[model samples]
Target: MNTTYYMSYKLSLIASLAGLLYGFDSAVVSGAISHLSNYFSLDAAGTGWAVSSVVLGFMIGAFSGQFIAQSLGRKKALLATGALVFVAGIFTAIPYNFTMFIVFRIIGGIGVGLGSATAPVYIGEISAQKIRGKTLGFYQMMIALGILLVYLVNALVASWIPDSQWGTDYAWRYMLGAMAIPGCLFMGLALFLPESPRWLIDKNRDDEAKSVLTRINGAGYDCQTEITAIKKSFQAPAGAQAQSESLFSRKYRRVSLIVLTMALLANLCGINAVLYYGNVLFENMGIASARTAYYQQVIIGIAFFAAATWAVVNIEKYGRRRLLIIGSFICFVAITLLGALIWVGIASLWMLVLMVVYILFFGGTIGPILWIIIPELSPNRIRGKLMSWATFLIWTGSFIVSQTFPMLTDSVWLNHLFNGSFPFFLYGLFCLLWFLLNLFFVTETSNKSLEQISAEMSQA
Candidate 1:
């Protein structure tokens, strides 16, 4: 008999590692950007392009992620992403000019895009309803873990070569390229994991799907009952194929808009702005030196990871929407205070404290909840495609904010008027708006099965 003890958690944890790689690849550049910019002779705009070009690749991978997940199966899709990350990391590390570096960074971003889109769906499908919220939240926890880990790595790697020697040495390359280790781990574990049983059932491989489900659910569990629910989720009007349930259709218009808006707003709150360009922002805000910036970042990373873990532990108990609301209010206060502090020229230490507050609230509430909510809300039949689109919108928001942040901050005219605090004020407003959006439209999905969520959403 197949053992179910800890199997579901074990599998979800493996899939969640993709989030770790996503975090690693995405945030690794922050540590290396200053040196890389100097090495490549990039101005602010060029630096923005260098940093954001990978997001373009993220959009591409997100756009195509559903097709791959659906056709190739979730396990294989992740396997491919792992390979892409591994290869990209290796090439990005090799001593190369800016052109080659950007190329490989984009490739790595594709892996991130694919992994971001698929991991939640894979975990949502594989995990039991009893632990679904926690399971899905684990992906976000891993993302936070990855970011925290990379920050520590960046600090260590940056110290290896002094600023004077960094340009000539391989330090920057090592910072960006260190992501290859986790990418390889993601791929290796994915090799041992089973496919999303729901995905297999979708492909008509029922027996194999049953076998996988039994391993996850215990031999005595009624795998057929869950199988029936999966099949029933695809039930639609006469002659309607599941894939044709386009998000733009009348059936999904509200949910689609919610997904897109939330995706965009989620990124617009300026989290990436901080993570990708922390050094630059802190310097602009009157921080002392690059070393100081690294220390602050390590602190921020620790707070973020701790908060994400807190969220993962509590999401199932507190309910998703409630946390977001609480998070939204605190995030608004923290971010607004952060901006005002910068605007009024408060002490850098005070500003750092406020920034940590904002990150803690955001990580605990909004960041992890969305990862769970998006997949839970999608209809089972077109789950992958909707997830793909959501991923696209997510990266789109990330790319826009990430690309424009440098330009906005570096703008002489804007900086002159706002004292280099314009972007934070803008982000604060967006955070408040997100609070309203959630209050009016978002529904609670805590402690519910995917099927229940789909049905509830369809009726809503």
Candidate 2:
């Protein structure tokens, strides 16, 4: 209700638009994949490649995001990413061949990778410690909104075009290209936003950093104390030079390992495989027809959006590690049940209900918390580098899942073992594993200052 809180929310919300672009760009492909397969005469491998190519680009962009964010500043890096998204969107809609389509998809994916890496880091740097978790959760909320919006767009476009033209023509094009509208909005608005105050402090622009921090933290807040704490975080120990150290150096080894493992675990839990192939999976389960699958996706998206909103509200209240462990257990149960239902040839409505449950658990827990926790775990001096590395790992995991889900399900040996639902069963096992990992290894970071977290990591 405070005026300064509103200002902070406005800024954080604007930056979070990058998440929306990432979500829309990523999910739009879900609706287009079946059409693409028909249009290109794709086999399982080709279909997988078409769907997962963006993740390949995501890996590349994430790998390079640190350099871009450090060199050009986070705002500029995001603006460039937005431009790339717009270009990729336009080209993707009109690609002359499958190869060209893949290229454009990769390009858009690079933008997604960059935005994903930078936006949360930017938001984390600007946010007050008390509200940081919810603020970062806002980025995940935007991602959910983007997915929901794309599903609606896909449904509308598919309905407008005749069924005969669905596989061969313009409907998919419109869906892929509609991403450009948000891309442009992100670029234009990013230009007006300030650079990260922490980043400015790192660059020794103390006056400017103080100005920005004062504005965001409001008139009553002690800007100097916050700034001092930030400065203290960057100070090195007796023999160590903070700026000279790599993220993988002995000092950061523990924190780096935690973030890298968390990132991999987040994607390997099979979130993207579900998001990217929900329509096909639903049809495979006999829950809906291909035409009806688009509408079903709208339902899935709504579930995801609502769950993410719940996460944003309750993340600080419940603590990150607790929610992740609980959510992972829920996901494990839901996915295992789903696999069981399929194996037994039970095509009841429970299958649909379980899918929604799985999504709710995922979106509320790992989906948003992964982003929130990573930023909190890393020290400001290496935050960009560490986040980029973690995101790279995340996308690598995503690429593996998105590219192999079809193959895993279609595997002759696995099919023999689990009646063609092997992948979901395997993912369910992963959820259980992740739950245990979080229980044993993950730390509670809710309501902690970044400086306090950095100190804790350093001590550990």
Candidate 3:
């Protein structure tokens, strides 16, 4: 096939809109949680549940994603997710009772988790080798774009109201409802885009896959050669069955271990803690007001955008493991600096810079790379199912972090442990540890195709 950028770019860009849905839904609730707590007359634990209910939904959705994706096909699975999100974004905004509110929010959570799990996998399968990393990074770019949109929307929603009115019953409703616009967009765009060629091939739709590759690579593209290469890649002794067996067998233990560990490490590097609870952290650090803190949250979103764009532009040039290694080291520096600033009582302005810098480092590398690598790491036979499992673990890790951060900061005396510096220190440790781990084990996957990667890993 002629490996041109035009077709791949369009598909990757469209698929990435799902990222916007994921990012918006994930962070939108943060701004609304406090206001909703008051409206519902809830205590800390109740509020905790309000915030975590979505994550619970994510876990449920992720656990079921393999079956859903396998049965529905990638395109249909994503479309189903988008439809759920469309309903969720609007329903979540209604002036219903707390029970109703939680239920709808859970619905939205399902959309977020399922889309987040499948979108990049779809992109990874269809993209040509030359631009795979950049295209894959587009998923993270869309995610950051979604985050930025919600942050701005959240700030705008809160900003319009008087301080006294900010916590009123209606404030949270508008914030939660704002996500509907993009959710609907994703649903509509998904309807128009082509399904993954890999998926079509999996279903023995070689003619369709040829059409897709031809479309992607232009009419002159050699559909037969492309199809043969794709087929041959799966022709090794292990073939599809061996790929499945090795995933759980001792034979592929190392591959299985690497995928799981990388997923955990991705979360542990502290991106969610920064993205999800950033506003709260800003306030805890004496950022002065909600407005200031919210704006700072927007800056974090901006940094994520800039970094993701860079990753998309350079991922192939830098390769996966190198980006992770470099990014992890940079994050170590950023977080360490942040911890030191808090411990030494650096200027408040400096503290915000530290946070922004940390996000910048992470956005360029860890955020995008996680999505880039996981799909490629799995064998073709179990790619969808195993990737679904990986997605579940990612959310499980996210849920743990989201639920614990507040308690850690409030109950465990994290501030006292390091004199208001413990969180950054803890994050720094994880980043540095990830850096060393990548140095030793994470394989370089820049120019290599999935078939090549599998061959090397199986031989090793």
Candidate 4:
């Protein structure tokens, strides 16, 4: 391969490792949390808190990531995040008590949150607009890969230890500790990639920006032209920064609202709730064996993996808005069927089939596509901060849905009102609302550069 192509490929690989860290953080706990709950002799609410604590830490870190990116530059911020996660992973595995375990999980969560926000922003900033969407798909693909890796790893670990030992005290520690090796690898790789040129230019290091851009783009492109375009985007008219306050600022109200709505749409389709709580959901539905539930959950991870891989390859061709519209409708139908099957007292097998279909729809369309839209919609100057705030909201939505699912399902009052299908019905409602929102407000971004998209949005 050509030297420039080789460098670019390596850089993309390193940046995408952050996504792998993200995926591991998400999937590892699903296997370990159950054992931890039993070891601590915890109740349902305590178990939920143990599971959702990382999400809360993620919200805090995401909220903090914007300022860190703006002040530190993408490369430095990512390195710091990786290092923190490395330590967090160690802390997570060695905790001797419940409080210590929760504390370490929170720390690890900070790493996940920061890496999730920074990796895509780094990939988006460094890549040429022509291939930017595809580059970001690598980030999402690794996230799916990481999820798959953790599930397989957890299964192997669980098999080696007797069932009595799994919850006796050590299984949870081993599950969390296994992450340290990957976490360390991510940190080492991050050290090799260059800082984002757009961030360098924002720091007024024009010569350095030119050097980095040249390395990524090769000898044929005009560095001056690229720099000028970035400068224009970065330095808007007077009071423009005020207009770009956030997804809620009056100046950015339309774009902000669209981004927030999409983030909510992504989470409320109930994918995380399903992933985090799937084993229990299966058991509750009368899948008699523990091993059977775990094996089924692994199948869910495979479905997620396949869908994300397909998305990474097809996202740019299909476009973000189109996928959202189509995916929302598909999810609506799936959830509607899922609820109907339960409400009508269908075979348990049918519900499992619907769950797989739901996973397929969410992973293929919404999971990968939501991140694609989030970064693309923001102007370069504010992209990091806006993405951070938006991610904060997404993590918050995850926390809410994951925490509330059990209560919604078990509440006698809600059961009386919704007749044992409240979670499905509520998610179905979210899916329908998401579809309408997309039809009315979201814009087509296919074939447009980020610069062009921003220009169009500004004109509007």
Q: What is the TM-score of each candidate against the true structure?
A: 0.97, 0.97, 0.93, 0.95
* Candidate 4 residue-wise lDDT at 38: 84
- lDDT tens digits, residue span 81-131, model 3: 788888888888995698998898788888878887788888988888778
**Model 4 regions lying over 4 Å from their true place:** 1-6, 239-250, 416-420
Once model 3 is optimally superposed onto the true structure by TM-score, how far is the C-alpha of residue 418 displaced, in angstroms?
3.4
Specify the poorest-scoring 10-residue window by lDDT in model 3.
236-245
Q: What lDDT would each prediction earn against the true structure?
A: 0.86, 0.89, 0.80, 0.79
Report the Cα lDDT for candidate 4. Answer: 0.79
Every model's Cα RMSD, please? 1.9, 1.4, 2.4, 2.0
Please give the ranking of all candidate structures by TM-score, highest first, separated by commas.
2, 1, 4, 3
Model 3 whole-model lDDT (C-alpha atoms): 0.80
Q: After superposition, how far is residue 111 of candidate 2 from its true place, in Å?
A: 0.7
User: For this target, which candidate reaches the highest lDDT against the unseen true structure?
Assistant: 2
Q: Residues 1-460, candidate 4, lDDT per residue (tens digit)?
A: 4455566666877898888887888778887867877888877778787888888878878888998888988887788778877887898888878898788778888888888788888888887776677777778778888888888877777777775765557877877888887889988888888999988998999999999988888877699998999898877578667666455555566777778777766677677767887777777777535556668878888988898889877888888778888888888888888888767656578788888888887888778777777888876756887899888888888888877776777788977777667798888888898889888988887667788777766554
Better of 1 and 3 by lDDT: 1
The CA lDDT at 50 in model 2 is 94
| Tens digits of lDDT, candidate 2, 139-170 | 99999999999999989887886666655677
Give the lDDT of residue 236 in candidate 1: 80
* Worst 10 contiguous positions by lDDT, candidate 2: 242-251
